[model samples]
Target: MGYSRDAWGFDEYHPVAQNGSNLYGKDGIGFMIVDSLDVLIIMGLDEEYKTAREWVANVLDFNQNSYVSLFETTIRVLGGLLSAYHLSGEDHMYLTKATDLADRLLGAFNQSESVFPIKFVNLNSTSRRNYDGSCLADIGTLQLEFKYLSHLTGDPKYWNYVEKIMLRIDELEKFDGLARNYVSVSRATFSGALIGLGALGDSYYEYLLKQYLLTNKTEQMYLRMYNEAITGVKKHLLKRTNSSHLFYLGEFYYYNGGKKTRFVPRMEHLTCFAGALFALGSEKIHDSFSEENLIIGKKLTHTCCEMYFTQATGLAPEYVLYNTNSTGDTLYDNGRKHNVLRPETVESLFLLWRVTGDIQYRQVEFLYLLTFKEWGWRIFQSFENYSRFPEGGYTEIVDVDAIPPKRTDNMPTFWLAETLKYLYLLFEDPDNDLLSLDKYVFNTEAHPLPIFVPSEEIRGEGWNRQ
Candidate 1:
């Protein structure tokens, strides 16, 4: 029902082999849809969650061998359902589905190595280690999910395991206190010389520092690491091209002086990272006594809005070339593949709107609503008609213009959770920033904090320390 052949025009090549079982490429598209739910709910959009939850429950199952990427599916769906449970108090049928998925995910945790891969493809098989389990780049994202799991199950292990993973990732990222995309755990070498904050890397840093503050462990090292990552993001990932701030795809440093290349930032990458930073910064306001930290949060929120959103459409490109002057770069002019108006970017916009009473945020959301009503409806109709993303979520590696007329299986659910949650909070309060704070949100790792307020309160009432 989620991605049916009728919803898409699937015929011979990309046939609907198993009738929603193995519809897309190894259930990768399934993961995306699940991720989308997470993002929507977080944004405060309840309807999206209901739709996505129903979609996941009826469409996907973990029993199939083809659904190995279900590890992420486990976290998102379970995490989302738990959030739903939190919202409704009365359990939904979907919560059972989530609990079942959680049991499967716990089984997938490798006690021997203490590492979770991108997914649970094979248990005893080593062949699934494509990036040597480095595929867990954004695995830090599970921070909130893990915390939620611990809260529900009354087991600290879920939160503890995620924290260990964060510390492990922190050690890996500690070269000059900035995180790199790829790391060879076996060889202890950072291979993916490309440095930039795609969703995964960027979110990890946000959680790391934010988690430390939540746990009352915001030491100098934590601050240093967090600041450095932000500095690196601002310095390397951001670029100004003809009055537009473009986030590059990825950067490859030719330390040996070979051809240097940087990819433009994809829509997926920017939307997720921007939201993560906003979430981390928004937590500062809850501290109440820390005006300095609150200011930092305000700045981060402001930057995210400035860099990503536009008046034309809340929707953004799949990717933008960092250096617009260069024509031959792969990062330039990548269009939209999956034409679906991803709800995740809208979630980021809502988060800022909720924090500051900016009427412009509503304008942005209105633009998105208009876009969906106009062009995006076709994408949803196609998704309902067929199974693909109308084209695909990617557009020529970095381009978003080329809509292949089919959606993929990689929807970011955090977008759903974040967006819906923010919207819900906005309607619920519309004023107090206090109510919007995530009580036990994830830090960079899976560490569950009682609260994520600032470490020290800065009383700037009368002036300087001197």
Candidate 2:
């Protein structure tokens, strides 16, 4: 509640500065509070939830004369509100807030001659223009939230806009089903032939399977695309180091306009999400390829976890470079050495444990089957040891590899929304009682939106049924 008193409703909190600021679009909005609402609800922090709920009901506003990221806002703010609506017993306030926000963002879609959304939208501007081009994930990652909004409101506009992205992107250029990073919104064409699954490209593949899973496994197109992308991932981007045989996700770039291709042996913290994606794909897709998915999932997750352990602070850096290094040494770039409280590795560990039912996966600090609480506790202790502010909340480390790691005042919003929530769910009921994978599909932001059958109206639309 210290935050409630000191920095409530602010977009971000800087622990050392003891101040709050808004950077997403506006000042004094619920960017901090709203993004963390579903976390408050599922953890059964009722008192905290009450405070946040009241803020959303009374003070949260989506209307403003400003531009906000389509991907960031959709995944964090819009996705959080939508998830809160479901988690909070179908509260109308959250639904109402989500509707208003979605409407403000809807202008970004369909204005382009393409189905993909523009990079940003002027929230309250009366005049709309074609926005700058979007990254692949930014354009492709809105499906789960927007489709769920369509389901709740009985309005097809949300679904139509997002669904067109899937439909149109399916018809575009791909390397055995993998898409490049740059998406041209105005022209309906991809901007480049560079595929970096570490960041700009991770969620595009994630949403493919999730869209299939979100619609109750009825969307064959998404399944086909997901399988193809994973196959392409294996064929093109998956690499193992000669040093330790650690599996890592690399990048693919086409230099001569699809005539020549090169592989770059680089991975980032963002690439950790692919571990969970592969795990989910392994379980959901019951075929001969399931074994391959499981193998890659485990190995890739091991590599990602290695990032945390190999560092001095037990926290992973932003990214790393791998090679067919003969000496088995992974080169850590000094420039990219900070640990920013990223949740990708933790998220992957949680889902991997859930998928494999291997208690060892939960026990990251030891070889034994340590209790899940022990795992979360040890991980928490590491953060507290290195990043906790004596005043309140936690700060990020400037460099985890540095002895007595340097501290930064900034705490990114995902620390609450994802890092804490995944840690909680890692051990929450271990029996699949809360936010069970069978029942809920998490958006890329880690907000859990329940899976439901599409309405007959939704089911009959085009190849959504096909």
Candidate 3:
């Protein structure tokens, strides 16, 4: 609980009462704080925003030699900076800082032998850590931030690097337009045949739709690929619970040589984003398939809400496995019964409420608040049993099904960046127009970036009739 400069360390899990310094040195807390900067602006906390901005500008340093996750740094630090920069009236300092961070991150994509970027990089050295293969999310989620940076800075390299990833993905052999979860960057070959709208593959589909919107629907390739992916999803991943008839997405591995397909009746909190994303895309396209997409989105949202209602603590688990043969609603234990306070469901709830004007969607806010209160109180009471600790922040739920739900010693950055932020947006008046879907699209991490009108010179290649 003692101090170490201005940085805070990870929550101690084994001891449960002790905290340690940052593994990456003194700026870890600053990086975490930057993730919440947009939340301050969203809540209209001017003084807090100013203070945080000052701290970031003065205290945060990216010159360290620590190795960091490419995906994490881009989405949180770069995405956070870009969102804050746009929201704060295009402050030059934010843009400069964001570009600086992004330039260093560009090292990840510098591999000449591979079509995709490496998984991690050292900020100080511009050296990359190669992984065996990259997931769909890692390959495809960079378009929003990088494209936005290109549009702002007029640097084609940022956009061109990320656009290459999209084009490479389009060339991959897919089963009905569904890409495998992991792809070898150097070989440009898929490692597995499994597919889902969850972790590894979630944002690949996400960026397809978002890239279209970000480019003012001028790019037909994005829309065509997204529609094809949706078709593949409906054909392969769509499933319904036996009792509730609740529609959810599941994962499956397809074997070569006509072998039997293996299906897994599981869903993750991360998959909930598809509901809102689909609904949002429907509103824009307005084609024959739009209504079907909207319907699927609504059903998916309801099923995600049910994940919370079925749990004892009114909180959804990190993942759930369904009983495929049960006549009644039954969830199988997959040894992942804990909730990490993820925001995907609530984020979709907020977006669907905006899209449909449904009071029911807005009403989900009460469940979120109730769950947070119940969990917060229990954790606070448990803290008394441990040694005296610092104030503020909440931890994950070890078991949502527990009577007095057990608590994990970790708190994730998304709890503030996405969970509470989306909940806050849900309660805002409709007239505020803070995050109008027509004007901005959110990155996978829930950071909002303005949708830009495509330049006359901007034209995407590799287009064909659908």
lDDT (tens digit, per residue) of candidate 1 on 370-444 = 321222233233334333333432111122233333334333333323433443443444544433444554323
lDDT of each: 0.43, 0.82, 0.74
TM-score of 2: 0.94
Candidate 2, residues 1-466, lDDT tens digits: the string is 4466567888888888887778766554477898899999888899888988988898877778777878888999999999999998899988889999999899787455566677877788755654566788998899899999989999878888888888888888788888888988877878877897877888989999999898888778888888888888898898888877788988889765678988888899999888889889888889998877877787787788778778888788889898675886488889898888888877877887788775554323324345334545666678878888888978888888887887887887899999988888887777547888899999988999988888866543434434
Residue 455, candidate 3: Cα error in Å is 3.1
Q: How close is candidate 3 to the true structure, as a TM-score?
A: 0.88
lDDT of 1 at 258: 30
Locate the minimum summed-lDDT window of 10 residues in model 1. 457-466
Error of 3 at 457 (Å): 6.4
Ranking by TM-score: 2, 3, 1
Candidate that beats the other on lDDT, 2 or 3, i.e. the better one? 2
